[model samples]
Target: MKETFVILARHGATEWNRISRYQGHLDAPLSEEGLEQSRALAGALAALPIKAVYTSPLSRARICAEMVAAQHGLAVTSLPGLIEICHGEWEGMLLSEVEVRYADLIRQWRTYPYTVRMPKGESLVEVEERSWAALEFMAAAHPGEISLAVTHDTPIRTILRRILNLDQAVFWQIKLDNTGINVLGCRQGRWRVIALNDTCHLGGWLKAGEQMAL
Candidate 1:
């Protein structure tokens, strides 16, 4: 049974992230704090034998991947499957605004994400399928080695759910901070989650007032 280590990281914070706006597929540049966070993450991962790095095409994720890859002298391969779930009309809205317009749907999303689909957007099931496929592709491509996959919140959550074999209804139970790391060990199609939302690398830089979203 050959073992492969998959390190999952959420992209660093963006202005939208600071304002608590829904990023979804919208492109947002990393904030100054975000750059610092990426540097911290890169430093933390410098000791690992990262064979390759993969990222979503979105700038936030791509920037994070590039930072980490540079430390290990690995180029990043962007994969569309790792892009964030499209939030349709909610892409730029704040959570409070979403609550005002789609109260019931927002409730369903927080409580039972699998039961509600975003208007003109994707369902949790759809996100899970594509993200799981991305993970499987990485595992097959880098057997017996360690790889880094940098993506967004929803996609990371979907991958974690699949790796843990958890129901989609439990989606909101997970919390992933900006630049947070999740470790998964895969062998022969089986996975064991070693860590979830590990942000110790951020040191005291993780501000208590910072907001996070999915």
Candidate 2:
């Protein structure tokens, strides 16, 4: 059976996003703009027949997933495999700081994204292995259903690269804007990329509200 997909969206921005910090495992709430982005994305997917919703466990991804799931009156299912690649010791460090300390390692990691792991982060191969396994799991569980997977930018983007058989070196070249929707599908145990990064949901530039814990 062919599993049709409507949209797969990355979570909105967070506080760490503004500072360009490595939020590997640092769980933080979304900023005002992030919430607006989520609402806008939910509006984008409202016209589609979203059968189910999958989300990463982190706050940023979860919040975004929940927002969209609520629009469809469906509960968001947590998938550990969709979680961000853990950055370990550098979870909350600034990108510039890390670059200064681990210059060569950082360069190699960026250039050869598939094999290099940060000092304590996961390798691209490790992330791909788990993400592909998770995709297979979703495919088996929800056959022929149009669904959504709301996850972190890194993992979602990596999944796109792997499924498209693109060069790992160009992973970052496919930028996933805040609340972007990248679509993929599963037909007969195989995956196909329908769309890369999309952000038409946000309409135009949007300003966020004040930070209030929800």
Candidate 3:
């Protein structure tokens, strides 16, 4: 096996996304726009020679992965590590409310996650470690095979940072939109980022910037 390429797909829009909820671990279905996003994403990936598929157990990610996997007659296996970070107390809080309640903590998270917690959530490192483990496991499980993983935003960012061994501040510099596809290829003990936060399929239909936050 020379290299293994994996496409990281952030699940399409969710109902909470429309209402601006935390949506960390709460399972919610995708909105109508999310469905359209999934369709477009599946169509965009239709040409790729995908061999296997993995998805977060969450409905939104699973749905998107299911549609894409259908194109190649593949079955999606839900990987627990691919699930979103467990936000604990902040699971369903609005970002604005978190800012008001955990003001200093939020600032510290934005600054450095060394001393921040979402009331009772997993630390940033916990998410970073587990998500990378998932990535490593996926690459190993399907060596030299083109695999696709459907998951959430923060986990994807954390995994990317791990692959690059980047500094903590690098987290803020990255952005992932709804139904966005990030392509990565692991080869010869190194990972290559082919694409990041790509949303060309919907023809700019994807919401960006603060709209990407949830």
Best by lDDT: 1
All candidates: TM-score: 0.95, 0.90, 0.93
Sliding window of 10 residues with minimal summed lDDT for model 1: 204-213
Model 1, 1-214: lDDT tens per residue? Answer: 6799989999988888888899899898999988988999999999999999999999999999999999999899999999999998888899889999998888888898888789998988898899989988998999999999999888888888877788878887887889999999987778999988888887633552446444
Pitting candidate 1 against candidate 3, the one with the higher lDDT is 1
The whole-model C-alpha lDDT of candidate 3 against the native structure comes to: 0.85
Steric clash count of candidate 2: 0
Ranking by TM-score: 1, 3, 2
| Residue 143 in model 3: lDDT | 90
Given candidate 1, what's the lDDT at residue 182?
92
* Tens-digit lDDT string for candidate 3 (26-126): 99889999999999999999999998999999999999999999999999999988888777887788878877887887788778863566776777788
Off by over 4 Å in 3: 205-209
Candidate 1's C-alpha runs over 4 A off are 204-212
Q: Candidate 3 versus the native: TM-score?
A: 0.93
Estimate candidate 1's alpha-carbon lDDT, on a 0 to 1 scale. 0.88
Q: What C-alpha lDDT, on a 0 to 100 scale, does residue 176 get in candidate 2?
A: 69
Candidate lDDT (C-alpha), each? 0.88, 0.77, 0.85
Give the alpha carbon lDDT tens digit for every residue of 60-96 in model 2.
Answer: 9999999888988999899899888887766777888
Question: Candidate 1: lDDT of 107?
Answer: 85
